[model samples]
Target: MTLSPDEIITVTLWGVPINATLLFTWIVMAVLTGASMLITRNLRPDVPPNRWRTALEVVVQGIQNQIAEIAQGPSRHLLSFVGTLFLFVAGSNLLLVIPGFRPPTSSLSTTTALALSVLVAVPLFGISRRGVGGYLQSYLRPSPVMLPFNIIAEASRGISLAIRLYGNIMSGAVIAAILLSVAPFFFPVVMDLLGLLTGMIQAYIFAILATVYISSATAPQTLSSPQKDAQ
Candidate 1:
């Protein structure tokens, strides 16, 4: 049984093979992009809403609320990137119900890319909120001797995030496959349902962890504020 979508080669560019992971990632992105365009095309401010619009609003609002809570009021600046991560991941996993479809997130390469996005984003958001100097100074906090450890910790953070997501999604797929092969019946259906729940949870966890990392990067600025105590 194929464990990673990276093994299923679909296309190649100049002898560098492209696999299902990359194909599905593009498919998911295209689907999401098309859906968003369709959903918002005729949007009106005061219309009695349709089901699609209502559901979309609920999801957007929920993401906004989560970002507000986790990032502590930086939701506006982060909604696009953070919200897209959640939506992409959740949508990828949720597509398992479709036959012959595999989630790209099951591949370490894909998960690593996602985690690296967060890795880069943490610093960028930090510098945007604080300054480049403040973000860099975080590594030497309390003493310069801690810089090496802090740097190691930052690198490990990306690895952990990638492994955590890849392991969970890949394991779930394996379990479901084993059950399906053995029984070819009811248990697989149940597993699919459970997988759906697990996928959503993983998506939320990934997004929240990202928010926490960015929040930490931005924390020094807030703490250094003289008026922070009064507010």
Candidate 2:
């Protein structure tokens, strides 16, 4: 059985080859972009909203509220990035129900890329809000001796994010595959349904953890307030 979508090569670009993970990632991006354009094309503030628009608004509002609770600064600044992260991961997983479609997130490369994005975002948001000097100073807070540990901690968070996502999604896919071989019927259906629910929960967790990281990095009192924000 194929353990990763990366095993399915799609094309070769120069000497490097593209895999199922890249193909699926592109597919997800296209779908998301098209959906966004369609959703907003006929948007009118004066007229009563349609069911699709209302549902879209509800989801956006929910993301905004979650960001506000986790992050100290204005949530509007974060809405696009955080919301996209949740939607992309959730959407990719939800599409698993389609026959022959693979979730790119089930690949380590994809999960690693996602984790790296969060890793980069934390510092960028921190630098944007706190300025380079202030953000740099955060590493030395509480005591100068803690600097190495602080740096290690920062790096470790990214590793944790990548492994948590990769392990969960890969395990679910593996378990479903094993069950399909063993029973080839009713059991696989139940596993797929459970995977759908698990995928949504993982998306929430990954997004929220990222939100907390960004919130902590952007907050004025980084050392002190992050503890509470995490809680």
Model 1: per-residue Cα lDDT over 99-210, one tens digit each? 7888999999999999999999989999998898988999987789999999999989999999999999988988888888988878867987898999999999999998
Give the lDDT of residue 108 in candidate 1: 94
lDDT of each: 0.90, 0.89
Model 2, 1-231: lDDT tens digits are 787988999889998998989989999999889988888788877878878778899999999999998886577888888899999999999888888789888988888999999999999999998999999989988888999999999999999999999999988988888888889978867987998998899999999999999888889963458778899
* Deviating ranges (above 4 Å) for candidate 1: 12-16, 46-48, 222-231
Q: Which parts of model 2 are misplaced by more than 4 Å?
A: 11-16, 222-231
Cα error, residue 21 of model 1, in Å, equals 0.6
RMSD in Å for all candidates: 2.8, 4.3
- Top-scoring candidate (lDDT): 1
Model 1 has an lDDT value of 0.90
Q: Give the TM-score comparing model 1 with the true structure, all chains together.
A: 0.91
* TM-score for each candidate, following the candidate numbering: 0.91, 0.92
Q: Residue 82 of candidate 1: its Cα lDDT?
A: 88
